[model samples]
Target: MHTTPHPPTITTVAVPPGSAIASALPGAYFADSYETTDPDPATSALQAWLSTVAQVPGWTNRLMALRNRLVRLAGLKDLGALGGDAAHPLRDAASYRVGDRVGIFRIRHLADDEVVMGQDDRHLDVQVSLTKRQPPEGPPRVALSTVVHVHNTLGRVYMALVVPFHRRIVRTLLARYAAR
Candidate 1:
């Protein structure tokens, strides 16, 4: 009898307490992380994940397309198209200096094991960080986390609408990484 292999697991982790991205916005109204065992260098792994995620197909693409339309109608900046002539969808650490634009986000900080990106609009400021850590056992772990601070009622409402989809996408991306 033939059987299919079980998919790798993806875990939702608490955002690291002292992460640089966590510091970007005190009292972040929303924050969460998804992690997987990935032995590759953090930056490279994250870059690859971003590239792959950007090419999302099927229902995910449909959702994102709807999001793009809604955000545009709301006068919010959409994450511009990624990975055409560029090597990766988001700017790489080697090419991005602080303040450089990467899609809808801006490069806030970069390190060998982590990269922090942020976007600020009238409603809120959002920060995302990808970090790599080596635990005592097993393969290295990579975590993707985001922190958002709402400025007003609109910010709160916007976050409420996006958080669910955000979690789904993050988990899906982590699962993809684990599968690789």
Candidate 2:
């Protein structure tokens, strides 16, 4: 494996319950780290989408809060490398093959916004859509709403799966860390 830029450390900011803007674009953070370079194409698209969110006033804090939660759950240390490999748990989880099912559920939605993927009782739900127009050409675009939910399996629970799936997808599609 080739060594890449160091992953940005996950910053634990003290966001008051109702202080900052929710859904505040991830671009600010990404720009701060990469000087707005957005190495991954998906991230570039995300930055554009966030720009739309930034236009809204009150929604900022709400969106920021949600983004914070999603980022935390993703197990991603850096928003800079949204597509680059940094140790994703969800992708590995979805790719797991045991017996018949791996206790993961996924759903994919095209022509919509938000790529929703999660592990239900025994399936992975993945949804992909296009809410806003994506950047001209960058990484695979995914909605910021994309997420991975975990479920309890019959005494065979792998919680790490949810975390990594979200991380991989975010860094890959939404953030474009994995974009060529």
Candidate 3:
């Protein structure tokens, strides 16, 4: 049997700032940005990830639906995250768990500290980093994001669910599976 990485779901709750849940790990991971110079391994990795997830049966429909949303969100040339209505499926499937670790990836903002000779700019370059975080005894996290230009006016939209909420997502998915 093929095992896939699943992120946790989000519930109604108040969490502290800078904390995991408050940082929107799951959503951010899906819509994260990487450096332009970085290796383009995600194209293959993402395909493999989706393939592995789809093999689980029953959940193929749900997994594909989320993948489409991710494609649309990334196809946009804008420089921001992807946003959607509350009823959007992506919002609901934002959380999942493969095993014990809750899949809540972190989005880190990387700034360039160099200066351009001909261009007058303060921050030369800025990028975002994506990393997975696992809870005490949950599924392993998958960290990843796309690269976008910050100067774009369209910006980006993402479902930001903090790290603390990761457990909530995992708990929900697990309960649903357990009920079955």
Q: Flag the better candidate by TM-score, 1 or 3.
A: 1
Per-residue lDDT tens digits for candidate 2, residues 72-101, read 564522222222123321233233332222
- Which candidate has the top score in lDDT? 1
TM-scores, all models, native as reference: 0.82, 0.25, 0.21
- Report clashes for each candidate as comma-separated counts: 0, 42, 30
- lDDT by residue for model 3 (93-144), tens: 2232222111112223221211111111121122222223343664433332
TM-score of 1: 0.82
Q: For candidate 1, write residues 100-133 as lDDT tens digits.
A: 7665567687766676878888888888887777
Off by over 4 Å in 2: 1-130, 133-142, 154-156, 177-180
Give per-residue lDDT, candidate 2, residue 150.
28
| Candidate 3 weakest lDDT stretch, 10 residues | 111-120
lDDT agreement with native, every candidate: 0.70, 0.29, 0.28
TM-score winner between 1 and 2, please give it: 1
